[model samples]
Target: MRNQVLLIIVLLSALLGAPVATTAAEGISISETVLKMPLADDVSMDDAVDSMKLRANTLNFKLVAHLPLYKELEAMDIETNRIEIFQFCDARIANEMVIFNPDFSAYLPCRITLLEDADGKPWLVTLDLGKIIPSANLSPELLEKAKMVRDKIESIMQAGANGEL
Candidate 1:
């Protein structure tokens, strides 16, 4: 039978380390994370960071670090402006996540950057855990924790973008 013959071919190919056949070789993966949101029209870069910090504080995510990228660049004599990052964390949430998988530390103390483009409109950008969650193989409870943290992060970033909360 044709199906039997194909099965034999597939087994032999597997032994030879060949790729399995599929209808489309260019399938797009769902692991991609989309981040980056528009800032309030008339807001300045500093205002963006301020708004983000306020929102994070309201949610009990303590401020961890504030890195001024533009200033750091200037220290090396590179002329640039309107770029910095705000790092914060909720230890309880982070602890619950790590217990499920220590490898999740790579995403700890989440950060968001505030930057402006040529038009001087500020922007808030950060990575989405959903982008990395698929491969993380988290359990239902851990997945819920991840989503909870992710939701908080997105909410904070959006609040900062709107220059409110």
Candidate 2:
């Protein structure tokens, strides 16, 4: 119920074009919950995906899955812009996170989405690790691992947006 309320608040903020504000207790802002990056105009979706995969590999993160949601929607005769999700994971870190708190498994195998908005502009979107990391009360080593994961994901997003490996 609490999570649902937070989601509603975030969605309202996005829809109303309100500036992101942090929740005093959690120290989490709407911006930190939803990170979005616009893709360069010159970059093709294929190139962007390739760049993301290459960057993930370089960072030792495995590409666990690719979900072409738009394709699925099309199969159902639904009209929608291109939308795809890529899941990546560092198994060792993920295992440790889960061991630390079983609830953390829900966040395992981090995902990034590639989609076209109403204006046909491409974007890369993901949940900011900051939303959870700061509140997780992690030990030093675990915190470092989590931060590394966050940094690597950000690097992947940048690579995709810039079409750079």
Candidate 3:
């Protein structure tokens, strides 16, 4: 079953011409971009884009651009603010939470999502799940931290989504 899913992902990537590594300005280097934005309870879309433009030079982060789904996240909310960025590398190294790492690569796979409302504002949301998804060789410690980050976003979104300023 696992092999089947892996095959499907690979096949889809091939069909879509998705590269394992990408360097596009529109949606790469998200971690670095999130880091640049100011930490505010409320942030605007223009602010997020301006921050991305300003700090584009300092980002070394990389990710394959998944278009349709990525665009869909925008419909979720407009006033998106980066809740947080978890570097699975550093988190694992510090043994901060419960996780599972197999190769001990010092980190786990990362997933980045964007929060946005109808207004078109965006918040870059990042999470390092710490190899929780089977075959992962990571310390359990990091997993907890990853969950914490995820939960934090959930809480923030709940409040923001409800217009609870």
Candidate 4:
């Protein structure tokens, strides 16, 4: 039965032309939709992004780009100042992952977004790398890199949530 399911997943992946997530029996989950961390009242968007930048640097993740979506939209006449995304990556870790599974490129340069709600409260939303990386069928070396990257990402977000530098 498990083999049959695996076959189906493989077939679907082949048709889609991208790696598909595999799930274990008994309804075991291997991935998450989004992880949210509430921001304190005193933490502005600028402050959060700056904190993330410092933390990412300390963790050895290069800051690829910081997208200011709110400003872009506002320039087009949308009223907003609350959506931004931080893109960071560790080339060593990414190279290890890509050498084994090039499909990992789909998630390269991990992005953590800062979103503000209507009530003026901010939140951090990010893909759960802890779940995604483990399920990627990576090699031992890539797996170790994944673990380290995941830990660093979580730490960065935690610092941002607590309004810490």
Candidate 5:
């Protein structure tokens, strides 16, 4: 009986130890795209982007923990960065362009992270938007659109983890 129990433990550990694979969010085949953005001479854009990435990871972990379809997401190997466009990509969703707010001491309208890839394109990711900008109402329409986008991204990530991507 002891030997059977030991065998079961070993099997469980082996399965649990296996790496959970994940692909980029949004079914977006994010092969190391190198995008570079012009940075203010004195600012640390890279560091700011890194900070946002950390927050994104935390957000993803929390979401996974809360959602049933993404329990395995806690173990996912994922990455993200910030991207900016001169013209908005999805204007229907958000009219205002999202940018990095380096300082957040008093009141922040938006929290921005500029992520740079090997090639140097900076992707701008954001969070804490509502708190940062307490005065302005983030449109309900935009929020719902954002939720849809997030769901699609999560789906893609799960598919990637399952080697379906």
Candidate 6:
């Protein structure tokens, strides 16, 4: 049954001239699935996080939760670089998305992660919604909303990277 579904998808993609997301032997490309931005040398992690929070608020996205993962690991005596996650949501759009497709619930409340590389350079990362949303087969109206969400996320990332409030 799974093979049948896969065949059908391949046929459809061929007819449409769209590239299949993956093959039986291939994994998803990291470049296609993630968006990452590096912080400027002068911008501290605190400033970037503050800028992101301020941008989210300005865009009316609720800062739902924050997880200071590094602190927890530190408590466990695990030596690791700084890592934190911030979750944001627009409830109205999120609800509409779930109503349209239950699977979307799995992606609810978008997330951004902040981490420091081995060299101690800060970076912000998030899912590349631009690549995911087009495959969801959303209605035109919902598609616009989804794109808005993606844009807002990119905006927030930019603000954080630039340390712009």
Q: Over the stretch 6-104, how does candidate 1's per-residue lDDT look in tens digits?
A: 434443332222345544542322112336688877665656677788888888888898878778888999876467778889898789778876756
Which residue pairs does candidate 4 place in steric collision? none
Candidate 6 clashes between residue pairs 3 or more apart in a chain or in different chains: none
TM-score of each model, in listed order: 0.74, 0.84, 0.27, 0.77, 0.23, 0.84
Which sections of candidate 3 miss by over 4 Å? 1-42, 52-56, 62-111, 117-123, 130-135, 138-165
Find the 10 residues in a row with the least total lDDT in model 3. 30-39
Model 5 bad stretches (over 4 Å): 1-137
- RMSD of every prediction: 12.5, 3.8, 13.3, 7.8, 18.9, 8.3
Query: What TM-score number comes out for model 6?
Result: 0.84
Clashes of each: 0, 0, 22, 0, 12, 0
Clashes of 4: 0
> For residues 65-96, could you state the per-residue lDDT of candidate 2 as single tens digits?
99898899899999988888899999999999
Off by over 4 Å in 4: 1-31
Error of 4 at 89 (Å): 0.6
Candidate achieving higher lDDT, 3 or 5: 3
TM-score of 4: 0.77
Q: Candidate 3: what lDDT? A: 0.36
For residue 55, model 2's alpha carbon misses the true position, in angstroms, by: 0.6
True-vs-predicted CA distance for residue 17, candidate 3, Å: 28
Candidate 1 local distance difference test against the native: 0.68
lDDT of each: 0.68, 0.84, 0.36, 0.72, 0.31, 0.81
User: Mind giving the per-residue lDDT tens digits that candidate 5 earns over 1-165?
Assistant: 543343334332222222233255522111211111234344354353333334435444222211111223334643323332111123223333232222221221222223344454333332323222333344665455455434433332323222231
Candidate 5 local Cα displacement, residue 117, angstroms? 19
Give the lDDT of residue 62 in candidate 1.
87
